[model samples]
Every structure is written in C-alpha cells, then in structure tokens.
Target: MAVSTLMFAICTAIYIAIVLFLGYMGFKRTKGTEDYMLAGRKVHPALIALSYGATFISTSAIIGFGGVAANLGMGIIWLVGLNIFFGIFIAFIIYGKKTRQIGQKLKAVTFPDLMGKIYNSAFMQYACGLIIVVGMPLYTSAVMIGGARFIETTFSMDYNLALLIFAAITAIYVIFGGLLAVIYTDSFQAIIMLLGMSILLIFTYVSLGGVTNAHEALSNMASLVPASLASTGMTGWTTMPSMFSPIWLTLVTTIILGVGIGVLAQPQLIVRFMTAKDDKALNRAVPIGGFFILMLPGVAYTIGALTNVYFYEKMGKLAVAAAGGNTDSVIPLYINMSMPDWFVVLFMLTLLAAAMSTLSALFHSMGTAAVNDIWGRWRNKKPSLAETKAFVLIMIIVSVLLAYIMPGSIIARATAMFMGLCAAAFLPAFTHAIFSKKPSTRAAASSLVVGAVAWFLWTAFVHIKESEPLGISMLLFGQNAILPMPWQVVDPLVIALPLSIITLAAVWMVERVTTTKEEDAAEKAI
Candidate 1:
C-alpha cells in the first residue's frame, strides 16, 4: 500500500478506537434514563462546556458556513461576533443557570419535559416534542451533508455512501449509549477540532504571506465581486453588503439573527444546561464555551474568506468559480489544494469529528423527543432506553434520507431555516417557562403553533430560494412574488418572532386578568 494511504488508515483507526472507547465508558457508567438523558446531572464543567461547544459548532459552521464565507467574504465575520455574544455568552450567563435550576427542581430530563411540566400540560410536551422531531432533521441533514461532502471530496467516495457511513457510525454510539456517550465523545471530538482549526488558521495565514498581506490582497480585489452578487449590493469582501438589499436582508436577518438568537431555543443545546451538576458548573462553563465558540467560527470564517485569495493565486480563479459555483465544495476543495496530503487526512478526521459529535447529539435529542416527550406522553408512560434507542435508529434513517435528497448548497439554508423556526416557535415560550411566574399554558401553546406555522408559510411563499423550489409562491402568486424583494428575502424570524411574542403577551395578559377577577370575587364572598 502507498505510505500516505497506510498512515491515514492507521490514524483513522486510532481515532475511531479512542471515540469508541469513550462511548463504551459512558455506556458502562450509565445506569438509568437520567444517566442516558442528562448524565445524571453530574457531568464535569469542562465536559459540559466542551460538549456544548462541539455540538453547537458542527460541520455546518465549519464546512457549510465556511464555504459561505469564501463566497460572501469577511462580512460573514459578523456572525462570529453574534455567535459568541448570543449563542455562548447570553445562553450560558443569562439562561443557563435558571434553566438548570428549573430543570432540576422539576426533575426535567429533556427540554420538552421541562416546558411541559412547567406549564403543567401534557399537550405542551407533545407539541414541543413534535416541533423538535419534525424540525431537527432539517438541521441534522445539513450537518450530514457537510460531513458527507468532505468525505466525498477527500476520498472520492459516493456522496450517498459517505452519508450512510457517517450516519451509521454516529448512530452506533448515540443509540447505544444515549446522551452520555454523545457528550463524552463530543469532548474528545472538541479537542481534535481545536487542534485542527488552530493549525488550519496558522497555515492559512502563513501561506498567504502573513495576515496583513492576505487582507491587502483580498481587499484590493473588490473589483472581482461577481456581477450577480454585485447587483445585490455586495461592495467587497471586507465590508458588509448594502443595507436593506435583498442579499443584505438575507445575511443579517436570517443567517445571522436566526442562527444567533436561535441558539437559545435549541433543545440539543438547552439540554446541556441540565447535564451540569449545579449552577456553578454552568457558570464555570461560560468562558470555556465562549472561548471554543470564538475559536471555531473565528478561525473557520477567517480561513473561509482567505481561501478566496488562495484560489485566486493558485488557480487564477475565485474559490466559488473553481469549485463550479458550488458553495459547499469551496472548503473541501481549498483544503485538498492548499494543504499537504497528510494534513488533508488529519483535516478530514477533524471534519468527521465535527460532524459526528453534532450528529450524535442531534440523534439523541430527536430520539428522546420522539419517544419520551411525544409517544410516552401520549401513552402516559415512560419509555425504556431500548425503545428510545429504536426510535433513534428510525430518526437516523429518516435524516440520512433527507441528506441524500437535499440539493447542493442546501446546507447553510437548511441550518438557517431550522434555527429560524426554533427561534420563532420556541424562544418566546421557552424564555417565559424559565423566568415568568405565571406563564399561561394557552399563551405558550398559541406562540408555539403560531410561530412555527408563520415561519413555515414565510419560507414556502416569501423566502425566495425556498419559495421557488417549493413553488407555492409561483403557483399562487404568479411570476412576481406576493411580497416585494426586500420583504421576500428577509428572514421569517424577523416577522414571525414578533408575532410569537405578541401572541404570548396578549394571551398571558388576558389569563392574568381573568385569574385576578376570580380571586377578588372569591375573597369578597369569604
């Protein structure tokens, strides 16, 4: 066998061995549903931090969003700031502690369970569970696609085969070991990701003749912005797109706000708060999680934008152009061309680590939501671990099918859509569940239904890319959209989130007034 191939195979085996060993350890220690679902709420602060970070920043951020950076330029860095601020800082500091407290007090094991119990409504759990089971596969499929794309580009494997392999490996640990295995493996993967991304950043800058030189070259090439993008207010790589332009609206509102604020409502992420031992653990994890978040996107987005310069120098073509206009291909193609063959092997593992860590968490979340929150609630019984594992296998199969059928360059949009949906549907209700004293069940239910439905309708009819594919807009509204350009392109969250908040507030106020009147009447009679 060729030396490089042999070395790669050996390294891959070792990595797999380490991951499987950790999964087994988690499995051995797991004793019950609590252990499986939340690691008995005794996970180390560092493990919780690392697992949360790893799960949050998956191949979607590294490969899909990285490719976007290559096409969109440094302006995408704004998202990094938002991720650190909203995703890590606000998530852990403002929400994490209370979520853990409430989760523990209520003995809630999952996000849906927490919400349902807090609201004292079985229907709430069913609704929340349904939202997760239905919406998460879109995000999961995006992650699968990101990982599969790397494997396809790196090893010249069939995309479908790569996806199945990826899903199978992730499912083995997650379905068997549950969240315990998922988080333990996630910590291991997080380490690999940090090293790989650090090395990638240094190598990227060195290859471009240092940071200053790279930025200068990239900045000077503003004229290279494609006419298609330029028409949509793309000024240059370094600067933000024109304010209120269709492209600008999509980037800031949907891509940035949707994913950024949406992190607060993500069940997979929210469950991490419950995994920690105490408020201190959650607090201690804040900076550590923040650092990881800062590093992943800070490095990935920077390198993604800088790749444009590398492709321009090496191939005399832009990164997107050389990759045949496929945004998803930009990262894998850049790595193959610019880095050493050995590094390619290592980087491929890094991407695998990223994809697997996230896929495991997602699969675990979906499985538990399907079985414990949805089915178990309906049956008025607790589901056994084995039953949950069976459902996990089903979820994996469905997500794999989605990964196979989703169109190219669908990764980023899918991630954004799922996050946007969560933000609209769950954020208002979730926030109130944690903080409000008299959170009305009716209000929460209305918000969940209205927000989700609004987001879906907007995507089907107004989100230009999805609208055309779904053909709802074209079929109903004709050639021109029912909404105009900026409105059509603006993310659903911008519109739907406010509606959800309004619904929640309006319902809650009415409920509160009625309760006060009834209490007053009873007191007077007494």
Candidate 2:
C-alpha cells in the first residue's frame, strides 16, 4: 500500500526538525577549530561508537552493495564477517587506540596532522590533505547518490531535486556545528538506523515464511540462475561463485577485501579515535561498534540476497532483471513493491540517516584536511573557525557537483574505488606512523606517490571503464587491457597494495643503510 500523504508529511517534518535542532545544539556548544574538527576531544564512548559505526555503514552498503548481493548471492555475507572483524574490531582495538594515543601526543587534529607530525614532515601533511580534497568527494558523492536515489523513489520526486535537498540539508549542520554537530547527529541517526534495520530483518523472515524456509527457497533457486551469469560462473543464490571466475575476482578482491580491510586507513574514521575522551572510551566503544557493524550489514546482505526470491515469486523475473539490469535500482524497487507504506517511509529515513552520517564525516574530514593541513602549512599557522567553516561549504559544493555528474550504477564501484585508493596510497605510511619509526620523509613520499600513480595508471589503462576514454591501453597494446582476461578483471588493490608496501620497505632499508655508512665514516675519522 502507498503511504498516506499525511503520514509522509508528518514523518518528514519531524525528521527535519530534529536534524535542525541537533545542528543548533552543536553550534551552541562549538567554540573553536578544535571543537569543530575533533569534537573538543571530550566525546563519550557511546557517541564515538555510534558515530563511528554510522559513519562507516552508509547507503552504499545498505542500498548499492545490497543490490549487488541480490544478484551475486549469499557469498557477499563474507563482507559482514570481514567488516566486523577488520573494520570494527581490529580498527578499534589496535589502530584506534594507537591513533588516539599518538594523535594526542602530537596534538594532531586530522589524519594529515597525525602523519605529518609522526614523520616531522610538512610535505606529508600537505600531500595527504590534497589527496583527500581530490579523492574523498568521490566517496561522498556515492553517499549522496544513495540518499537522493531513495528520496527520489519514495516520494516520486525528481532525482536532481532530491539530490540537491539531501546535499543542502546535510551541509547546513556540518557547516555550522562542524564535527560536534556531525557526531551528535550521527549518534541519533545510528539509533534510527538500528531500529529500521531490525524491523527490516523481521519483515523479511515473515514474508518468506520463516528463516529455514527462506534459506530453503533460496537454495531451490539454483536452476533459475540466469544463463548469462551462470556462464560467468554464477552457481546459485546460496553458493559462492566459481573460483577465479570474473564474478569471484570482483567480489573477493574489489568488494570484500577492498572495503573490508581498507577501513583501517579511512581518514574520516581515523579522526573519530581522536575525538574520544580516553582509552576507556575507546575500549568501551568496541562492542557497541562491533554490534552495529555486524547487524546492519548482516541484515542488508541477507535481505538483498532474499529479495531475488521475493521478486521471482511476484514477477517471475530475478531482482536484477526486475530492476532493468541496473543493480542500483534493485533494492529500491523491492522495497517499494514488497514492503508496506509505513515501512517504506521508515526505511527511507534510515537510508537518509545512513547517508547523512557518512557524508557529514566525509565533508568535515575534507574541510579539515584543506584548512588545517593544506592551508595551514602554506600559511604556517592553524586555521581559524571561519576558515574551516568556509572550506566545509566548498567541499559540499564539490561533492554535490560530483554526484550530479557521476555515471549511473556507480555507487558501489565508486565506494570501492575510493576505499581501494585510500588503502593503496595511505595504508603503508599510516601503519608505519604507528608501528615503525624507520620510515623517513623520502620513504613516505615515495610510497605515497608510487601507490597513487600505480593505482591511477591501472585504472586508466588496464581497467575497463576509464581505459575507454583515456585509450592508453588501446594506444599501447591495441586492446582495452594489457593483461590477460583474469588479470584484466583483477582489482587495482591486488597490485597497488603490494607495491605500496614494498616501496615503504625499500626506502626504509635504503635510509637505514645510508645512515649507518655515514656514521661509520664519521667514527673512523674521529
């Protein structure tokens, strides 16, 4: 049943008022750049956990990748396990603690601050900020697309209008209140997300009869697998794709490993650790974040896969075909067709919250990177509150422009691309900052430059999409990819990450050997 216009209006009005109110509160409490960027470093455990978790899981996970699961099958559930183990547990327990300790030790306010201070190099800070400014909007654009698409579907509104409204509202709070507003709103949004997803889980089971019955029905869908997909090694909705298959390569390397492990180096997430009050807050946040991480994606992937069953029964077409082969549309169409009107309205808000929470973080991270790290280095001074706020508005405009211009069916791939790029370019240096001291400015610079260049070259020459436009591969190899079939489909991370690590190791070794020789010569002369 369609939602009554009255209910829709009431729900929307309430949600908007609450969002604005929280922004006001954040603005009232915020006093300076520190408060704007790091929430004054006095945030509690629950707020940090929820804010972190909410920032981590966005519409890309709930809607875009969820739709991919519908077509690809239950194997995507592996991402849920990975997200909890790597994204939350390892991130919070290992990386988060160290980041918090070292960040405070260095008076670091952003990821760039942490890196630059650890290495005592201004270039590291400036380069890191430039990268975030240039690349993070891709990720932010994905989040905006997710929320805007949902609003478009739910209200039957124009996509452009939906996109603008979503961007504008999120920009309002983030611009005025800064990180405090983002975190405060994020905690509340996380609550709504949890409630919304819990209800989605229950309804999915009820619709499919029961838990066992749902699995049984999905398992029985083996023969119904599309012949084209099966040709590429798709087996059944309940089974994993064939090993070394194209689908398998994309799923394992790109979707699962790319995002799951890449969370370690995400700039926005790293800053969350700096917002906490103490180690106790960091420790206290583990389980809360773990639970939110586990449940949200767990439910999303399950329902995503099961939506195939729902669509198959109602329309005789699989989820992908039912949504016109556009994977991005699968989840929204399923919700509209299978769910009641009230639930649709509720889920819309859940998605809106998810998108806004993540976008707020991304925008704030980008703004701080620009004003604090990049501009501060140029000026040899810290950014004032007004400068930070102005940059936040600039980032919002950049992200909105990207969202408007980005291709359709790109939300998931864009998410993966940004995450993969961050992992490739930032992970080695970021890890070294905490775990090793031998990496010099040269090593950091070489690793970052090599990692970023390798990833871009691969994408532009070897990857299918950008390669078409750039024609680097076509010019050099007379083909869209220089590699053979299996290698061609492999994600950039599979290549770039190893190269990044090796560069870091090689430079560090050279620095050590060079220093030792110089010291020996000085000693002999003495």
What local distance difference test score does each model get?
0.89, 0.89
Of candidate 1, the 10-residue stretch with the lowest lDDT total is 1-10
Question: Model 2: per-residue lDDT, tens digit, 1-526?
Answer: 4667898889978998898899889999998888888889989999999999999999999988988899899899999888889888889889999899999888999999889999899989988998899999999998999888877777788999988888889999999998999999999999999999999999989999999999999999999998888988899989999999988898898899989878888999999999888888988999999999988988989998999889889999899899888878888888888889999999988998999999999999999999999988899998899999898899899999989988777888889989989999999989888877455878888898888889888887776755666688899889888777777668888889899999998998999999999999999999
Off by over 4 Å in 2: 469-472, 475-478
TM-score per candidate, in order? 0.98, 0.98
For model 1, what is the alpha-carbon lDDT of residue 498?
Answer: 94
Which residue segments of model 1 deviate by more than 4 Å?
1-3, 524-526
Give a tens-digit lDDT track for model 1, residues 41-87: 88999999999999999999999889888888887788888888888
